[model samples]
Target: MTDMASAHLSHDPKWTRAHSIFSAPSEGADVALIGIPAHEVSLSATSAHQTPGAIRDALARYSTYSSAHDVDLRDFSLCDLGDVDSPDHESGEKKVATAVANVRANHKLLIALGGDNSITYSVAAGMWPDLSKIGLITLDAHHDLRDGVSNGSPVWRLIQAGLSGKNIVQIGISDFANSREYSQRAKDAGIHVVTRDVLRKRPMADVMAEALDIAGAGGREIYVDLDVDVCDRAVVPACPASVPGGISADELRQAAFLAGADARVRAIDITEIDATLDTPDQRTVRLAALLVLEGACGVASRKN
Candidate 1:
């Protein structure tokens, strides 16, 4: 009989581990992962800078295969470029931009792991210096149009930086999560918003298609901001602004996959999760890991 200790060491050929897929950058890769730990300027208190490592750890809990997409991420080359040092300050943002610029041309897709929602501004700026050439899609509970420099102001800052309001599409904006003033700000910017109620009524596929159409209009590359707070509070306790009536975990995963599958989607960021604030089970970080896999699945689908 096989001893218990020996059995624990046995490898299963059918089940490839997820974490094994990512390695140090070599040549160009199919996907590039970068950590932007930007919690210093978060509006709500957050330890989000610790999230990128937490998400990487959680990837060990998953596998490289996705039954939903009928693809294995192992088929693609993935690399982790490590974290941007001190990305929460002005100089750090400059580093974020430089890092993104340096790597964007080398990978098929770039996935930026957030320190906070604030990373959205730096990452997007890094992806496209001329913001007018790229469209924006944000999945979040807030309008993120608040004034000043913080997690809540990335969208507004991007618009001010030259991203056209008409080219932006925000999904899952929740009721009571944002103020009337910010709602007006979103409107005045001409940003298309698909509220949480609309998500409940429309199929995710349809919503995603519409978002991509608008944001990717005029052949613009797209950048997706997947703020976990758009999910139900129960689904993402680590997300400071999550509400009870937000979208489900599955819905957010679907959106991530859909965004990744599109060729126009050049970059994506997962944000607003304070790993230190997660539940005992670490469900939030686990979900964030799955979101990364889902996006990778979408990238794999593009080859088909």
Candidate 2:
């Protein structure tokens, strides 16, 4: 075998590129991953704070190339900015916005690994100084319209922060995972609700096309948030609120890729998984890693 093929040897630790394989953070790269490793301030719990690092570890076990997309991750330029440090949720919000603002300023794609869904408001606030010019799309099991500063209320928080409800589109909303009051609030706010049942009734590509069209309306930049809880409980063992029936793992990856490939999508985030609660096989973390890769693949394809 040639050196290149031989180098694929199973025992070759040198060829193993962990998640850290990406180039180090720089002002030059057009795509970057930023970690927010604290959920205490957002969820009122600290369990998911370790997820960012765990995702990187799981990523090391996989190849960077995607035969399906015909794209090799190493061919793309991306940076890992490590993690943001904040003592409280209030500060965490500011920190996240600042990080996202930095990415926007550099004209780069921001892939944020979140402490929880709360990161959405902060990211949107940072990416669009004018909320009126922004569109929000969330693939989540819940409306996230709760009336508090916790993980369940980011959508409501963003609306209060000046985001137009008409520009928000929520997908993968599952049964029994939300309250009637919150559902009514979503409707009253004019938020477009695309339930898990709706997805079941249509092709994923068609649903995503419609989602992108709605989210990109008026030429506004889109911020897509992927709450891991949107996936089935079997696929997201680490997401405490995840239910039994939801989108499949492959479907979620496709959604992320579609969002990332859209020119209007300036930022994306994956949230709500608690690494400490993950299965022994680390299936959840591995899936999260693949989601990141799929997003990167979309970015790479766009550049090509």
Candidate 3:
């Protein structure tokens, strides 16, 4: 009780390295982080648009050192490209596409923080001129093969836009999150589906190895779509559709690390988190921030 308030110290720049302070894209860097804070067509709430800013603030709490990957994030180059202005769905997708093209041209790796899962279509479409040369993997609870233009339909949209279903591999599809018709659509398109039940039976590393093999076949560049809804509800309170009994927080972070470690993984999208809906502690936003750094660790491990 001896003047505790007077003993408080400010956040030191040397000790607090926030993600927002990452260098600009014009300066050139190994990874380009773009924020697509557009949720015009999200199935859940509209405030997902606040995720990018919240995550940047949350990133200030964590150190850059990654003990698991044995990589210091301070050594890696990351350009924070800032957020895109997409007031509507069409404009959002178009803006994201243009930004992604610029990021792909300048950065070795592209990591997009999403307003929703719909950004996946824009990111993947923008990254590769020809879909045949690309492989897509989604770690999501839903198949996302719905009919309309919303968070629930990026996969269908990507397929319609020339992405070959054979090159897409979906993991962690939980029960009650998908429908029989979408399942048939995946099968019809030859999209590989690895159920959560199946995932539980095997180690994530093993499952990821097989997924990467399918998605990276014929030396294709991979784009990973990480929908936070694939995580357990407790970990991602901001993800409206996330259910119980899903992948653990550590497992999702490990997935991001593994995806980044592969040179074939050209880009990744971390989606479906609405900062406004997050708990008072901002756990969801913090996790998303860590995932971005974990992706950087993956890039560090990749061969030039």
Better of 2 and 3 by lDDT: 3
Candidate 1, residue 178: lDDT: 90
Best by lDDT: 1
Better of 2 and 3 by TM-score: 3
TM-score, model 2 to reference: 0.92
Tell me each candidate's TM-score.
Answer: 0.95, 0.92, 0.93
Which candidate do you rate higher for TM-score, 1 or 2? 1
Best by TM-score: 1
Model 1 stretches astray by more than 4 angstroms: 1-13
Clashing pairs in 3: none
Full ranking by lDDT: 1, 3, 2
166-210 per-residue lDDT for model 1 (tens digits): 999999999988999999999999999999999989988899999
- Candidate 2 residue lDDT tens string, 49-73: 7788778666776777778889877
Give stretches of model 3 more than 4 Å off. 1-21
Q: Candidate 3: lDDT of 169? A: 95
